[model samples]
Target: MDVVRRNNVTVTGNPDGPVVVLAHGFGCDQNMWRLTVPALAPDHRVVLFDYVGSGRAEPSAFSEERYASLDGYAQDVVEVCQALDLRDAVFVGHSVSAMIGVLAADAAPERIGALVMVAPSPRYIDDDAYRGGFTASDIDELLESLESNYLGWSAAMAPVIMGNADRPELGEELENSFCATDPEMARVFARTTFLSDSRDDLKKVRVPTLVLECNDDVIAPREVGAFVHDAIAGSTLVTLEATGHCPHLSAPAATNAAITEFLAALR
Candidate 1:
């Protein structure tokens, strides 16, 4: 299959500028990065794509077995980079896509040089000395609820994940995005996202990295942000004044500024 067609890849921005890939999180498509695209387009070649089973990606390309682990998503990133022949591209990944970027960079070091991890959490379930903000049973219950009724789970969880109750539209948009996804595919992605642990991957990131986190994200708390920063040597962590996991949607200006600043420093 043509990787671009399979992933619904969309490229924009300055043709002569450095390449920057914007990857969305679970239950989200490339549209989620609409607010941030213009900011980078002025000075960077921006690439956007929807993972299979999400957004307008070819549904037939989705395989539950392939997507049962985060490696599958990383493969999607690697293949997209190869299709574009991207060299040392800057990968900006949101939510679960952040870890996927880490994996992709490790898998194809020449394709990606730097990383911008937005609202990332290496592990969601808490362990002995770590606080991932959720217990094992919590994840189990959440997954069980989602498996039972994905739509209802989306409607109820989107608002919480968005974290801007004052602006209900953001939550509604996320809920709609979730609803638009194939439930069975979403379930697989959800299980894969919530159950996986990528803490060990942090130490392997040798490229320049910026870890962006929200001031109040229910999904990825401050502790997780600190852990990520401390784990990755020579990484910069910026706490946006935003209050949601999806800061690109909730606080685009701040998020874009931080990202653009990071890009500038690299040059």
Candidate 2:
């Protein structure tokens, strides 16, 4: 099978319309985009793919060293676009994937026309003058939880991590998504995601960018989103009324409207 197929690429919507590539965040795969895809599919050619180890991807394709860095994932994005011969396609990435989008756009400015970063965080650990919403020790504790009680950690942290405490169902969905991933693979991915520092790469973006910052995102605070917005030249930052990191899931309507407006303005 082709490389894109190995990644479990799923294409929908208008065959000849403007292309929109949706990259899921850290925990889950393309399925997480279920709530948001329908909105984009009507007008755009929507593309969804699972990262190597996360979703329905080929098990043998995942390499620990390759995925330990964001660049490897960025390469996947570039390859997906190249395999489809997509030029100037709009890239929409959530959470850690958002920074991956930034890296991809920088690497191939000609391939990506615009970028949308949902709850993006260039860095997760606070450093010097930066507020990344987490402390080094906090990350250590998180890793410890993952190691000690992988299942329990998944069940407990998913809700807290998802935010939107008022709605327990959303957290349940995230928990299920987190548990579906292979535990060992999830561990490595978590380390790679949280320890990663992509702050410097933001300025290299040569395409029009949009940063969608959600309210009450513990993983990516408002400061982190602002950092991304300030870092990328001429990037638009929109603060959604949707509370929680997974606004596309909990508040799909608002998330859909924001993405629609952003894509529309570009056209």
Candidate 3:
């Protein structure tokens, strides 16, 4: 119910069927999954919500220190699951939320039945052996860009997020999301997204999982997708031929079809 919003998120979905919790990534809110929800709602109970600072969540509820770490966001996921009494839930997370889902599922494995991670990265930064698909400098420039321009960074970042800055609407969409955030909170979110490393936690995931890889995704490169697939045991990997980082937007049908088939297989 509404009580779940106390810590983080604005939840929505069917109450009677099996729970399907859909989480969004950084710099965006649950609205990112709007297109994907309609397909899942009629058959399964669906849960769509914004993280503590993003989406329709009250701006006043966000905390810089509390949400500074991934655990804070993960805790919100756990709390919402507990409040709703959701068991054996299917968690569908995008980008950063996918990692958050991993952390939450690890914490409460008994409650989660399966995971569908879209554009997930266990560790974004590359190690000696692990190529997480990005370098320290890549993340540094991202943080710097976020700090300097903020709005302009989003405008520029949108094309990167959208994978098509040339597209006029991508610029506008990016502006709206960038401006919608609270400056301080946004800074903290950016820090969390770029800084946290969840590779260690991947081994802790005990439930059935699926990794949905987006081809030509800038945020989560194909290598990162391969890394996630290899790291998680007994997880299926599907490469989606979508251009933008947001597959649910750029290729909802493909995204939905993959998910629908996976859920059906579970049944």
TM-score: which candidate is best?
A: 1
The parts of candidate 2 lying over 4 Å away from their true place are: none
Clashes of each: 0, 0, 0
Rank order by TM-score, top first?
1, 2, 3
Decreasing lDDT order of the candidates: 1, 2, 3
Query: What is the C-alpha local distance difference test score of candidate 1?
Result: 0.97
lDDT of 2 by residue, 31-75 (tens): 999988889988999999999888898878888999989998998
Evaluate model 2: give its lDDT: 0.91
The C-alpha local distance difference test score for the whole of candidate 3 amounts to 0.83
Q: Judging by lDDT, tell me the better candidate of 1 and 2.
A: 1
| Cα lDDT, all candidates | 0.97, 0.91, 0.83
lDDT of 3 by residue, 1-267 (tens): 364565344445566777889998887877777899888988888876777788677666677888999988888788788877889999999988899999899888777889999989877788898776678999999898888878878776777777755566754675687778876788898899888888878888778898999888877888888888878999999999888788888789999999999998898
Which is the winner by lDDT between candidate 2 and candidate 3? 2
| Preferred candidate (TM-score higher): 1 or 2 | 1
| Model 2 residue 186 distance off true place after TM-score fit, in angstroms | 0.9
